[model samples]
Target: MTAMRSPFRDALTTALLLTAAVAIVAAIGTQLSGGTQRIIIDAMIKMIIVLGMYIFVGNSGLLSFGHIGFLGLGAYTAAWLTIPPSIKASLMPGLPDFLATAALHPLPAALAGGAAASLAALLVGIPLTRLAGVAASIGTFAMLVVFYAIFSNWTSVTGGQGSLYGLPVFTSLPVAAGFTVATILGAAMYQASASGFRLRGSREDAVAAQASGIDIRRERLIAFVISAFFVGVAGALYAHFLQVVVAREFYLKLTFITVAMLVIGGMRSLSGAVAGTAFVAFLSEVLRQAERGIDLGVVSIGGRLGLQEVGLAIAMLIVLIFRPRGITGGRELTLGWRSR
Candidate 1:
């Protein structure tokens, strides 16, 4: 007979395994060219974002399309703090004196970005968390739209549809991998926490959860804020990686891809989040290469534009058709052993 593992231990094991997997990928990327390394870094960043979504969407069983808005908020915040004051003055002339002149290190600026997103989540979640089902999803989408509109039109702070350049490029493969590991561990820990369980209970059966004295709304709000923080951090990393920030990049296209990654991986499981991201990232890369044309020795075959999106959509449909609970069937990855 085997002793049952504690939830904390299980969560730790899962996080460690996932971190090891990410490390392996990062190691392989180092052997490849710089472009490939960038792709790996970008994928790890996306993993962080997906894990953030998993924390809220997986635990609360709520679908949110607005999480990327928090990413945008984080990116802009990092830009505000880290960009040279001289650049800020010319690019964003309407900025307040403090932000205009203040330049910070990338690490703290990333944390500040997370904090900014967390605050935004807290403010929006107050009322939004009260809604459930499709209503809540729509509300989140509306929030995304609102964020995009504000970021696009707010010329002073966000640069108003213009790309914010001159950001110090500090996101390397190791940096992204480290953050990815931290995010995976954080997500696993959160899923094992009391708040996480309560929120999941509400997701499974709201009435029963509420009857058991669970404050569903409050739990949801907590998850929302926490998830936003992780995504915001990813946003800061993205800003540093690209050395540029564009409002449009944080809008609908990103919202769709991130949500799709979560859904395809098994939104209810941490392992699924990791797996889905890896699978989709690989698939997207393949499709992108094919779009650039594949040489078949005798004849070259090329794919049209939008191949990546189309391929992802088809892949998602096939996965949903066969595995309705996502590729992991809503199960965490674990050693194949039974506890007694």
Candidate 2:
């Protein structure tokens, strides 16, 4: 007898369950989940981060060690736009005199911020996408460093090492959850699209793609621009969620964590995105919890195990030892299961 082909059935259940769980949590934040609600909110934020990683690393088959820079750009852009003129005058004493006099709403500012970072990505992607493999990787890393340097020195706009606050908390649990669901669904849909197929084909074999009349550079540019747009949106989400923007938020460490999520999640598959994002987001929270302190009958460790370091080390070790291909191993969880 032929065994049933229900491989994705189980996975689809898991994805649906995850989405349902998020929806419930988002709907009942603070009302339930008690003190853990903030943690759930943060997990949703990380989901956005992982989704950003999925576009470039998953679809394009390129390792971009620098997309986090878009986060910083978006953060500052939104922060600048949301900040009241009176507040801006105080913290950012030297903000462009024009900006000090300008008035903008938070929602429009979010869009503007996203567009700003996407434009930057387009400019950067135009040349960088031409390089493939590890070379492209290096180029993205350079972009991150360049972005970081600018944010650090461009105090007039970014507030430098200082914090830029005053953003209204327009983004909350439900909004974030809605976006997480959308990004996951969108990324999965993108993978199955004709354009995504062409991009994947180019990533797999540029020479072959060129022989088949595919423009390798154009594909890369397209993927890069698209990736940048989402990343920027993710940044705006982050900015609104935090209600503050700072330079240190998307430093090299966050970049490493983002890369780790992609590598572990299976950069080539949508299942990998969901699995990797959920795993990393939830695990990081657990680490945070354990770091705060685990109670024991006899004695409590008092939570101070330096959870950040421990979490990263353990995450890397787990990915390397148990499953080098990351979660889902590049397989996607989709509606295909229903038809099959």
Candidate 3:
């Protein structure tokens, strides 16, 4: 018989391995051209977002189409806190006294962004967590729509539909990699915790979990808030990276892509989350290059607009057909020495 490892040991091993892998990628990115580096940084940010979604969807078997809304909230919050006072005053004159005059650093702004998202998640999760299955999923989508509408129309706070710029560009390869490692560790630890177990139990069998004294709603709520915070932080990083915040960017397209990454990688496992994000990001980048037209020695091919989206759709369909459980099959990446 194989011996079972402690949760802490398992989590630590997984975190260490993932961190090393990310570090290697980041290192390579530093030597690449500017465009490639941007792709790597963007992928790292997406990893954070996917991992955040995994915290809730993986453990609770709940699908949330609205988590990207938290990302938007985080981005806007960061913009509000970090944009220069003069810029804020002119660009968003409807701002309150404090936000108009405030110009905090990116680090603190990122934290505040996460806090804002978490608070919003808590407020929405109160009623949302009570729902189950498709209902819960739909509820979350509604939440996203509501956030999009508010951000698009609330000129005073969110600058309405206009893009909010002037954020310091602080999210480089190192910065994104650092946050990605932290997110990986946080996700692994959370998955190995008691709450994670309870949540998973409920996911597998809600009645049995409730009978065993698990408060389903509370567990879901906890995961929801924690997940929001992570995605929110990713949002802040994204804002700093692009130095701009746009409500449309956080809407349907992003929501679909991020959720697809989680699903294609296996939403049930953290390893799957990372794997899926990396796979899709690489594939998307390749398709983007193709869309711009690739030149070969004999024949030239490319210049296909919407190739990225179409390619992603086809890839997702293929994965669903052959590997419905995702590339990882809902399993964590582990050393061969361990036995399940």
Instruction: Pick the winner on lDDT between candidates 1 and 2.
Output: 1
Candidate 1 structure quality by residue, lDDT tens digits, 250-319: 9988888888899899988999899999999999999999888899999989668999999999989998
lDDT agreement with native, every candidate: 0.91, 0.75, 0.92
C-alpha RMSD of candidate 3: 1.7
lDDT of 1: 0.91
Worst 10 residues of 2 by lDDT: 1-10
Give the range of the ten consecutive residues with the poorest summed lDDT in model 3: 1-10
The predictions' CA RMSDs to the true structure, in order, are 1.9, 4.3, 1.7
lDDT ranking, high to low = 3, 1, 2
Off by over 4 Å in 2: 1-21, 28-30, 302-305, 335-340
Give a tens-digit lDDT track for model 3, residues 236-301. 999999999988989998988898899899988888999999999999999989999989979888
Stretches > 4 Å off in candidate 1: 1-5, 337-340
TM-score of each: 0.97, 0.88, 0.97
- Candidate that scores best on lDDT: 3
Please report the TM-score between candidate 1 and the true structure. Answer: 0.97
